[model samples]
Target: MAEPTQNDAHLLIVDDDERIRTLLQQFLTRNGFWTTAARDAAHARKLLAGLDFDLIVLDVMMPGDDGITFTKELRTHLQTPILLLTAKGESSDRISGLEAGADDYLPKPFEPKELLLRINAILRRVPQNDEIIEKPKVLHLGDIHYDIDRGEMWEGDNLIRLTATEVALMRIFSASPGEPVSRSKLVEDLGRDRGQAQERAIDVQITRLRRKIEADPKQPRYLQTVRGSGYMLAPD
Candidate 1:
C-alpha cells in the first residue's frame, strides 16, 4: 500500500530526550507528517491546550508525569490516537499502555519504518471508529443499550463491563448491523491473528454477550449466529 501523504496530519512527539525528539521530528517530517516536539507530558498538555494534533507519540518513562497516567487522564475527554514508546521486551508495560487508552505501543529501539507502519495502521483503524460512531445510533437489546460510540453496553442505568476482545467484536458487528459477519472476517478485524483458536474464542464472547442482552440465552434475539455465514446482530 502506498503511504498516505501525511502533510496535513500533525503528530506531537513527547519525550524528555532532546536528541530523540529532534531526530523523530526530522524523520517524520521527511516521511510527510507535520511534527511537533514536547519535553514531557506537561509540555505536551500545554501544546495540546493551544492546538489540535492528529496523533501523539508519548514515551512511557518520564521524570514526573508518565505516559500511562497522562494517557488515562487525556482519554477522559479526548479520543485522539496515542502511541506509547516503552523499554524493549516489556510486554506487561505495553499491555498497560493499551489499558490506559493508547492506540498502539512500540518498544524503544524500534525501526523508524516500523513506527511509520504502525501509525498508518492505527490511522486506518481510526476511520473505522468514526464510521461506527456515526451509525447504529445505539443498539437496544432487551434492557441493555449498547453505545457504539463509546464501545459501552449499558443495561438500564448500569454500565456493563466488557473485555477488550468482546469490545472489538462488538464494534465489528455493530458496523454491519443486520448483516452476517463471517468468523474469519471477525478474526481479521479483531487483529487477533490466532488461527482457529481465536475464532472459537469469539464464539465464547458471543455466548456471553447474548446472555447479557438476550431474554433467553438458548434462543437469542439480538445476537444470532447464521447457520454457516457467521454472526449477525439484528439490533432493535
Candidate 2:
C-alpha cells in the first residue's frame, strides 16, 4: 500500500453494485484519494474494523441493512463524514439520510465530477482541531454537563449513561442550545423513517432525557417546551 499524500483523504465506498464500487474506487483513487470499496453493509463493517476512513460514499438502496439504517448505526460511534447516493425523486430518502447523519447527498446517475465536488465540499466543512479547540464546547444543563467534543455526559463527578438514541438526541440538542428544535426535525435527526410512531418515539426519548437532567421531568426547567415550537435546551 502506498503512503497517501497530505491531501489524499482515505475514503470508503459502500455500494452493493460491483460496477459502481469499482468505478468509484478507481475514479477517486485517480483524483488523489485513497479508496476502499465494500460490496455491502457487512463488508463495510469488516473494512471499518481494520482501518480508519476520512469519509464514506454510501449507496442508499442496498439489499440488507440499507443505507439509512447503516448510517443511523454508524453515527453512534463514528462521526466520519458521509455522502449518500440516492435515486432520483427520493425526496424522503434525502431527508431520512440527513436525519441518519449523512453530511451530504447526490442523486443517482450523477456525474462523477459532481461527486468529487460534493465530497470535497463536505470535507472542507469538517471542523479541524485548531478551528474548534479554543472554543469551549462544554454544555451545562442544570448540574449535569455535556462535553460535546468527547460526547460524554457528566453530573459533577459521576458519568451519566446514555443509550445510542439518547446520545444522538443529546448531540442534536446540545448543538443548538436555547434554539428550538422541532419534533419533526427530531424524528429525522434520530435516523428513523418519518411517521407518527417516530415522533412519538422522540417524545419518549425527550421524557427520558429530562428525567436524567431535569430536576423535574414532568415540569421541565432545563429542557423546556416552546408550545408552538418544539424543544429547547436552556443551560444554566
Candidate 3:
C-alpha cells in the first residue's frame, strides 16, 4: 500500500467551538489535508465509525465526554493518532492528556503553524504499511498470537484490535522477545518527550495492552515486568 502523504492525509477535527472548528478545518484543508469537523465527541464517534482518518485533532473541553475521557475510550479499539487541544496550560494538564492516550497536546491559542508541525510529527511516527521487511513471524501467548509482519494479533480465528501505542510496543518487544525494554527506551521509541510522566504513560499503555495479551493481567504470564530492567514479552 502507498504511504499517505500530508497532501492526501485525512484529519478529523472535533471541537465544541464552532468558530474554532471551522477555522481549523479551513486552515488544515488549505494546507493540503482533507479535514472533517465534528461538533463534539458523539459526532466524532459517528464519523469515525464510517470514515478512516490519518489523525484526529480533539478539543479537551466539551459539553459531554470531554477529550480525556473520549481519548481513553477510543484507545480501547482504535489505533489512530490523536492530538489534543485544551485551554489549560499547566504541566499537570499536559501530563493528564498524555496519560489519557493522546499522542500529543497543544494548549489552546496555539499558532496554526505549530499545530500543523505537531500534526506532521505525529503522523510521521505512524508506521508505514510497507516499512516492515522482516520475514513473517508469529508470537504465541497462550491462546493469543501476534503477527509481526502484519502487525496484528489473533485469538483462534478472531482478530484482536490494538491501539497504536500497543502496536508499537509489540513491534519493539517482538524484536527481542525475551529481553526487557526500559521505560525510557520505550518512551523514546514511541516518539514521546522524555519525562517521568511520559514513562508513566507508557506504563498505562502497557497495562491496557496486557488485558488483551495476558490471560490474567494481574499476574501476566506473557508480558512480564523486570524488577530493575523493564518490561519483557516472554511469549511461548
Candidate 4:
C-alpha cells in the first residue's frame, strides 16, 4: 500500500529523552506530518485528554509507567495505533509489546526512515474507527450505571443529574477504572489551581460523587479511598 498522507495525519511522539524527542519531532515535522511531544506516560495522558492523534510513537522505558503497562491501559479505552521503540532487541520485550496490544514494535538504534515506514504501515491497516474511538461510555458502578458520554447516570428508568464538575470528574475516573489517581494530579487535570483549599475541594467532590454512585456513601463500594495514595474508581 502507498504510504499514508503525512499532511493529513497527526502523530504524538512520546519519549523521556529530550534530544530524541526534539529530533524526532523536527524530523517528522519536516517530513510533512503534524507532531506533538510528551516527556513521559503521565504527560502523554494529559495530552491525550484534550487532543486526538492518529498514532502514538512511544518509547518502551519511561519514568512513572513503562510503555507496556501504558499500552495495556490505553488499549482498554483507545484503539489508536501505538508503535513502541525499544532499546533492547530481546524477543521477550518485543513479545510483551505485542501482548499489550501494541500495533508494532521497532528496536532502538534504527533509522528514522524505518520508524516512519512502520508508522505508515500501521496507519494504512487501521480501520475507519469513529464508532470505536472511545471505549464503551456506559460503565457500571455496582448497580448504578454512569454514561461517560452523556454525562448522565441512571438507576432503572430514573435519570440522575450530574453537575458539570461531577461529570468531568466521572469522565476522568472512569477512563482509568481500578487505577488510583492522586489528588494533586486530579486538581491539575481538572484545570483547577493547585492549593490546599483545592485539594480539600477535590475531597469534597469525591464525597459527593460517592453519595450518588456508592451503595453506601459512608462505607463506599465503587469509589474506594486508596490509603497513602488517592481515590480509585473500581467499577463492577
Report RMSD (Å) for each prediction in the order shown: 6.4, 7.4, 3.7, 15.0
Tell me how far the alpha carbon of residue 52 in candidate 2 is from the true structure, in angstroms, after superposition: 0.7
lDDT of 3 by residue, 21-49 (tens): 99998888778889999999999999999
Instruction: Give the Cα lDDT of each candidate.
Output: 0.78, 0.79, 0.84, 0.78
Ranked candidates (lDDT, high to low):
3, 2, 1, 4
Candidate 1: global Cα-lDDT? Answer: 0.78
Q: Model 2 misses residue 102 by how many Å?
A: 2.1
The TM-scores of all predictions, comma-separated, are: 0.66, 0.62, 0.82, 0.53
Ranking by TM-score: 3, 1, 2, 4
User: Considering every candidate listed, which one attains the maximal TM-score?
Assistant: 3
| Per-residue error (Å), model 3, residue 72 | 5.2
lDDT of 4 by residue, 109-130 (tens): 8888777777776565443434
TM-score of the candidate numbered 1?
A: 0.66
The reply for model 1, stretches above 4 Å from the true place, is 128-138, 141-171, 176-187, 190-236
Q: Clashing residue pairs in candidate 3, if any? A: none
- What is candidate 2's local distance difference test score? 0.79
Report the number of the highest-lDDT candidate. 3
C-alpha lDDT of residue 174 in model 1: 83
